[model samples]
Target: MAVSSSLSSIHISPRTPKTPRAERLEDGEEDVELELLGEDERYRATQDLDGTDGQAMEAATSKQPISAKDKRSMVLLCVLYLIQGVPLGLALGSVPFLLKEHLSYSQLATFALSSYPYSLKLLWSPIVDSVFFKSVGRRKSWIVPMQFIVGTLMLYISLNVQKLLDDPGNNVGELTFIFTLLVSLSATQDIAVDGWALTLLSQDCLSYASTCQTIGLNTGFFASFTVFLAFNSEAFAAKWGVPHLTLSAYLRFWSIVCYAVTLWLLFFKKEDKEPATEADMSIKGVYKTIWTICKLKHVQLLIVMHLFAKVGFAANDAATSLKMVEKGFKREDLAIAVLIDFPFQIIGGWLAARWSRGDRPLRPWIYAFWPRLGFGLVATLIVYWFPKPPISMGFFAFLVFHTVLSSFASTVQFVGISAFHTRVSDPLIGGTYMTLLNTFTNMGGTWPKWFILKGVDLFSVATCKVSDAGVDIAVKAAECVSDHGKALCKDINGTCVTETDGYYVVSALCMVFGVIFLVAYIIPTARKLQALPTSAWRVKMS
Candidate 1:
């Protein structure tokens, strides 16, 4: 009898087909066909000597079936991601507005207060990944206790008053620190959820889950934020004798719900794999696996890409609410406008993926310079749209512009990321392939905010009203005039407009970079596809 060794699908090789044309694009889909080199090359080995062992390893790992239990876990994990958005929206974006109205701190400080916790999540991811208390029991383990801490933290904030509202002399630093601690704990819960999620979802399903997760997060956040805002600003006021609870207090109440849910998950679930220190790890350990992935060509491209993709939209993502406030849009109007825009966003993302799935080549994203140039034209037209009014509607103007551009590009992005990861995941290392993608994806996510904050500091905001002819003036005075002129020019009557320069400039810049990257991302991806050895596409049976 011959001894037989089944392929062990514990490792993966990065030999997926080159990114499809639709996926190569950051904007719309790429449209290149994978034209393999001649028939002779059909059997040519894509795995050179350097990649052969890796390819075999991948083949071993790629086909593992996800158990039904695991699938359920994965779905639950994704829901957590979606659920993540609610508290995030309430605390991060909504709190800043409340703070702006109630606090003495300058604009920059207010922004920092809200965003600090999210940025530091990386610091805790490691800890969350490593810790396991067996006595606590199950995959959920310590999550129950953490939930209590998180819940109590929220409860504390919910009942508390905003110190900034009363005495200007009150210490904002202390209040914000406490707030950050609470938020940090909340973020830790997310890290734990993602850790658990990774274990639950099958490798093949990660991208789908991620896309769903993204939508869930954004949708949850928006819904929760809206509810909170309504209660804090409107409903709370309607209550008898009670000082309408502050936004902070409402945010705390929201946390209570999250914690309660978290506790339930703890009782119901347990980790699939317990903590393994480096000493306890296998021959090819987590660090080694991660290191191998980081060294791949596509991973490098992804890292650089993380910064570039977001840099183009840095101002658009983080500053929108504040920008709207500055632009004189009422909060209520801004809220409504966003509600309208978000649906379009979700639709755009779904269409990009679903549409690209058709057309054989599956080029869902259309990233041509010509199309983007057309976008630039539309942007310019928007700037010049309608008659100039006396008051500034800069906020509304910017919102509409960003909503259009961001949704269009981001939809394509959602698709591209899915396609890219799908292409990258080795059919052999079914689950681990997804793990690598998620890790890389997280890295990509970090850069945008990093670049955005840097860009905010690097760029100066200067404004000047258009004189009969361009006139010389002090920059600050011009900026003041520009700001005031913008504020004075808006009405629901649509009768007044101002000559807006800022949004127009930003839109133009977005187009410029959009076109440049579109060209850059497309040509190489197209050429790379055409160069892949035909044998790479062959279905070789061992």
Candidate 2:
């Protein structure tokens, strides 16, 4: 919903005129022209305008305008969002599954490092917003070079992945550092894509922007997590005449893809040439405008909601993946399960777009929220009931069902929140504002995973020993180190051996937070926020 028409309000104005001028562009669409009024006219506009009344005055003046949609631009935007998801899926999805076999719970949690760049991007967004290469245009100038670097890094990593995986526990540092750099490059490229969308689409075309993003991101994730994993599976590797399944082959394949896509976007994508505005010319003005946006009441509320919405289910992804491994599920099975759920996520997104519109914009969140909580609770019960495992086929079936349901619900909720942010965002600072909101949303999801990993370690007990046969064996406890004299405990080999019930603890916590937020915050906030005319969300600078 990138389609806000708050251009008049985004500027610093003494008083709004009774009637604003509408200039016709060469494309025959009308756009607002920001102009100041004389003293008498200013007085008329400013009268009875202060505090809440000023907010009301601002809402009344910033009307949504209609413009023609561009099919080509929408397609291009989707492609850009898809590219942004590649590194994200690699960091959040692919690497976790690969590492589960080699690393302990604590080491697995460190995978969150790859996503940290997303949470911090907001801090640097003002700089991105204020400066860019003039010749190539602002957005592409940043995107092209960053994407090329990402591709080069992917290629280099593909070549060295074998060396890094040689002794994964010992090499965790090298792996984390390299992947962190890949994710960082992807995150910076995301800043450019977000900002580019504002200038690329007209106000009328904004609503579809979220739809494009959801589809594109999910598509990219599918390729990176599901498809890539499938290719790296033993069955596929053997069929394709490969000797072994390693991340190296997958990374090498995607490296080619990244480079090709970079070339296509750099050479062929056309961007609108935006004339430098007052905010665009001044660095201080950029920060000042961001400060003003931050002061708006509606903006503040949206930011809080974005940060807390995911707290309820934040740890589910990490916890569930590790639990599946503990239950004897193979990495290939996990990947395929996610692949099956991929289409459903797209369907959920489509349904959300259709249902959560008009007067009840937050309906999708409400409809999906209860089911999500129910699934989390169900997961807890399942974990509690089957505490110890030589995992059964029944457990695998149940796991698949839970993953599918949760994935669908997550997609629906994400599209709803993303659409809300799009609708409220000012086109003037589209990239910065959108990235700012998403940064909080990403952070909310991230911190809980860290807590979950630490919680697992806290409740679990594990030990290892050298057997009489001279092999290292992991076990719940040791009879006597004196018996096997060389025996000692190691974190890497420490399974969730004794305190396996920790999974339920994390699940229950997710449910608790979900219910509290839904009742205490979401229910009341949605009513008041949705009731306001979309214009009420607009920020006015004076």
Candidate 3:
């Protein structure tokens, strides 16, 4: 859910002009020249040319200053992006922490499915891009309806969530289904906003769109994660002399905010009409382009790498915080740790960008890979030795330090790979190229999580100790972990006692796999890929 800022920085090339000239390449080779126009400039050029030359039009637009309308558009974009982040933050950050208290790791794994919709949204993005009602507005046709639906869904969940979570039936499947829908809608909104951003701002100030996305999305996520968790905690609320907010109340507040924003967008904000000269690719063409890109040998190799690269960190990323919570670490403390690490993530990204410059953009990523993996191992140790509740200030500080270090390394790797993505992505289809690579990268992190979580329960050894009418008896821990099993165990007055936690076992296995992956694939493949000329990454469109 925490996307790299580099994604927003993609350079989408303008449509190729009908007339072409020759230009010299850096290698002293001559090639046909393609002029790049910003989205706004392109739109203006298509309207009432009046014999104005392309260069003159470009110069005029370049000198045009930002207006009040443009500033309003920027603010609108930030709010839209912020709304998009809400469902994602709830699904990925807050819900998991809340569920871990009552649900088994396997159930939590099921809930993890909610986050996959965002990752797989790439599959449907072309459809969202290609189809829209022109009268209403290309972006608004999707954004308004999707956001409205998101608000409605949030309202529905706000009313029913408490009952669902507290139900003895263990409604994780229902929760997953509903949250999946919510997140899917959010992804749809993201697609629309991403497109709308192109024309919403002046050509000269277009780069600010990415800045808005980064700021808006991170702020929204922080509100939902750190602020929500802190306020939702009884101890934290009591300590601060504030009201303890429930998840339901939090969702309701956001739902109303979503409604307010969506209403404003529906009636107040008008999307700029797309130029008639600009033709969107048909959905079929979009799919064909993706297929063509996929067929390239370089792309194939990169996709394969993205699919498996995160396997090493799956256990640590997915289970470490939950394991710490299971060991009695308070959610408030966890939230605080995240709060402190937030700034470091930004700093790490900036540093990674600085380090990733030049020909080998992937060098920093390759360098950080091992340390990041080691941090995963270290996280497991931290969780293993996590002290009892009412933890000392010194130990809490260490935990914060570990989180900052791990997050810093992860951010470096993320930004470095994203920088490489920027370097190789074809400007003509920058959004699609970047989305394809990002989707694969997100999947690599997502798919292995459920298995890793399930592995914890699989490798764990626990037993139910029961005193049946004064006679001692033992039952399988699995028989006591489920909702029904817990009730059955309670009927017999039994307590589930964990002998060997699966966290340690799973973490160890992940460490071993990390080493294997690093030595066998990541190092060699990254080096080879980075050394390849940029030409290898470009696909020739038919």
Question: What lDDT does model 3 reach?
Answer: 0.71
The list of candidate 2 runs beyond 4 A from truth reads: 1-69, 235-245, 383-399, 461-500, 540-542
Judged by lDDT, which candidate is best?
3
TM-score of 1: 0.62
Query: For this target, which candidate reaches the highest TM-score against the unseen true structure?
Result: 3
Each candidate's lDDT (Cα)? 0.46, 0.63, 0.71
Of 1 and 2, the candidate ahead on TM-score is 2
User: Using alpha carbons, what is the TM-score of model 3?
Assistant: 0.80
Instruction: Output the worst ten-in-a-row residue range by lDDT, candidate 2.
Output: 1-10
* Per-residue accuracy of model 3 over 422-509 as CA lDDT, tens digit each: 5555444544555677778778888888898788888878788898789878887673433444555676688777677787888888
What lDDT tens digits, residue by residue, belong to model 1 across residues 145-248?
56667667766665564554453225566556665776566566655554443334554443344445545666766665544554466533564344554566
- After superposition, the stretches of candidate 1 with alpha carbons farther than 4 Å from their true spots are 1-75, 100-106, 113-124, 134-139, 142-147, 165-183, 202-204, 224-227, 235-246, 270-289, 341-412, 415-511, 521-542
Arranged by lDDT with the best first, the candidates are: 3, 2, 1
Question: For each candidate, what TM-score against the reference?
Answer: 0.62, 0.79, 0.80
